[model samples]
Target: MTVTRPPDVSVVVAVHDTMPYLTACLRSLVDQTIGAGRFEVIAVDDGSTDGGGAELDRFAAEHPGLFTVVHQPHSGGPAVPSNRGLDLATGRYVFFLGADDLLAPHALERLVDAADHYGSDVVLGKMVGINGRYVRQDVYARTDPDLDLYGSALPYAMSNTKLFRRRLLDRYRLRFPVDMPVGSDQPFTIEACVRAERISVLADAVYYYAVRRHDRGNITYRSSPAQRLDTARRLIEFTAGLLPAGARRDAVLARHFDWELSKLVGKDFARFDPETRSAVCAAVKSLSAAYLTGRILDRLSPAQRYRLALAARGRIDLLIQPALHSGSAPLVLEKERVLVHLPGFDEMEREHFVFNGAFDSRMASGIRVLEAAWSSDRLVLWIRAPVLGDGAAEPAPLGISGVPAEVTTELAVDGSGTTLCARIPMRALLGGRRHDIRLAVTAAGELYEFPLPALGRRLRQRRWHRGRPYRISVIPGRDEQMVVRVSRVPWRRALLWRKQ
Candidate 1:
């Protein structure tokens, strides 16, 4: 049965706390080289702060018929609001313009024309990440055989940077799931890719995707292996449910299973205590059978398939597990250990020390270092450590670390999950400040030096260093919308003034 297409084009702009990007995004939509009346922009306010709700009304007032504003509290992801936009859209084609991304002048015209020209349900065009003059690839280029995406399946990459037919969505009953912490674009695009009867890829880069490096919200399971595995398990179930009925699908499912298993057995637990490893391994054993039999595994690679094949055959091997082997101590030059907790997960990661090449180059690949600070209410972290033989370096010697004004030092456990507390009398004795304490940690057998910037200021003498901890920053609250990663950061020392 052939599905009929709609008459006009509908653009869904889901904004939450993204007031800053809204005006630009909306302007881009209405400024389409094709003119305003040709398409309708349905802007949904997903419970945004920073006056996003009111801004929607302002735009609607100015644009009138060309705009439709749907207001709802911030749902988990843009999926729900996008789905809401889908329900109200009357266009033959629909595209989600991420608030942070912009549309090329002809973005609408190109995709719209492509949909009609190829008689395709999906119209994919090239896109470049355009943050300032910095241009990055769109990830949808149809250049490599390895990146081939044909028919209803998407290329291995999923950036909602394409123009899709509204009819195709109706035909497949496709909608985004608001529940997934992240990678929601994965299932939504995959479903469309798998079911798309006709697809087109244009060579032109009409969409500009802005890559916000500071935004960490979309990366829920990035640092936590356990969380990623759990999310993968749920998504695996969803993908499996959409699979074709047969053993071919089982092979595809197996490949994905290997990945989740790797996260489970391979990452977090590769070096866990014996009891912890056994508990997790037991859990995987229980889920492996059903997971392998699921659908959507038809397109997996041989190596990926082999990994799963091994696990499926009760051959959970050591190679698939993630392990960390910290070798011998370095030349005992310098050491600085501070307890820090990044906002999201409940783990206190310690930045043991910053290494300087002052030691041995061989130490670079062996240790990992994290620079942590509280930027606004968000705890931001920048981590870089060397992979063995990865040319790791000791941290550039601390020019200095600056912290906030010296307040009365209090010692207590931050009940938060980062399991950290300065030993009681440890923090108390250091009264009003003024001390030349040089801390050092030998990471990779090198001696490096670090001076506390806040400590320097506490003395009221003077700040000698050129750099301070102010170097670290969070995204300043993401302009109040557009899931740019949110967290509850309390007001505390701007520096402890340990401006390092």
Candidate 2:
């Protein structure tokens, strides 16, 4: 009798018209350093019209006993195909990979090794965004052997891209919510993490999420505001039902409020049609009434809380005031209170709209880093900030350790704003550490710290310092903050580089 052992991992890819990107994704999977015997790829082509099914077949035919290609009619979303693939998985651990995304060469091996070594039922590999996609990264700051799902930043990154033990999943009968057009993976991943005995996170670059420059067929891109709101509401309801109402539940629900709910009231909210806007307001009001706990509200920034409160009260007119104020709303300072001057807010209602804390960076304007570059071994940031009365106050670098703010030049000054040049020596960022850059200034006697927004995707610099080489890059965070990562390069790899 012959015995066949299950593969170490089963990668489930739900595909739909991914075309050129699909080829790269499949190729990355087959070329994994873990070897074909260690992992199997189960691809479900969800009624792709764009030859994606043919591409999958070609790969399967070329690599026998490696790929399992399944074809099914379009089920309107990825949940159907992902569930089917999960049901067919025969490996000890299952990983859900996006058809439009690919993995690092050694991602599977590292994930499997970490999972086995830590005896974890779930493992999350560090994911980087390519082609301008923003993936939340706070959870991947370090390699944690045992991560707390509710106590940590895991809630912010509840995508189904992580590895899960098949046994744990089957034990709980976990599956994606098929009824959701978008964000179905959140519920599936959240439940798996909650049920798993232990969860691990790997800091190594494991997944590359690509955002197609011109592909609107992506489900998230195609989903309407209403559809996304409905999905968010459903997710909130699911989360509320999964856990008892308290700090633990509030910790999880905070993600939905900050992202899904707050996103609905962004600058674009003003552009939504009247009916759609009204519907969004009504839905937000209902959700807030049902769930929005004080703990969750406290977790939100004052700006976010105010915006959601207005939306919940069906104050679409007041909600649109911030967007129409040219991003710098009128500020009133009475003693320690900083109140926002919004139209139609009476004296009684005006107090409710006051900034929760002494600082509200959201209402501050012109704190953007228009350009970042290297000059004379120094990192230069051209910052735009509002000019206070008498043009006295200037934006200063804050929170960065051992680095002093050097405003070399006041580039320009106008009634709208002032552009200042801030320079920091690269040496200040050595020691293989990361630093978050924030620009602080005073407006209307109120101090605000704003995250520096980079104009481009990411910026990088390579240099050899103190007989060791380092790679410095400015990464744009998912929450619009900019991060500076300074990493030491291996000697062997550093030697291979051409001399500058």
Best of the candidates, lDDT:
2
What is the Å distance of residue 117 in model 2 from its true position? 0.5
Writing each residue's lDDT as its tens digit, candidate 2 over 43-97 gives: 9999999999999999999999999999999998999999999999999999998
- Report the C-alpha lDDT of model 1 over 1-500, residue by residue, as the tens digit: 99754445888877776656667777787788866667888888888887878887888899888889988878867778888988998987888777656787887887787778677777666666533324334445452222234332343345565678888889888888777655566678767866777667776565555534344322332335444555566656766787765663454345446555544544344455555455455555555656654343344433333333433444434423332112222222223321111111122112212222224333333332223344333322232222111111222222112222221111112221111111112112123232222223333444443321221111111121223212221222222210112122222443444453
Query: How many clashes in candidate 1?
Result: 45
Query: Which regions of candidate 1 deviate over 4 angstroms?
Result: 1-7, 130-139, 143-155, 213-227, 245-288, 291-500
Distance from true position, residue 17, model 2, in Å?
0.4
Per-model lDDT: 0.50, 0.79
lDDT of 2 at 258: 91
Angstrom error of the Cα, residue 269, model 2: value is: 1.6
What's the lDDT of the predicted structure labeled candidate 2? 0.79
lDDT of candidate 2 at residue 332, scale 0 to 100: 43
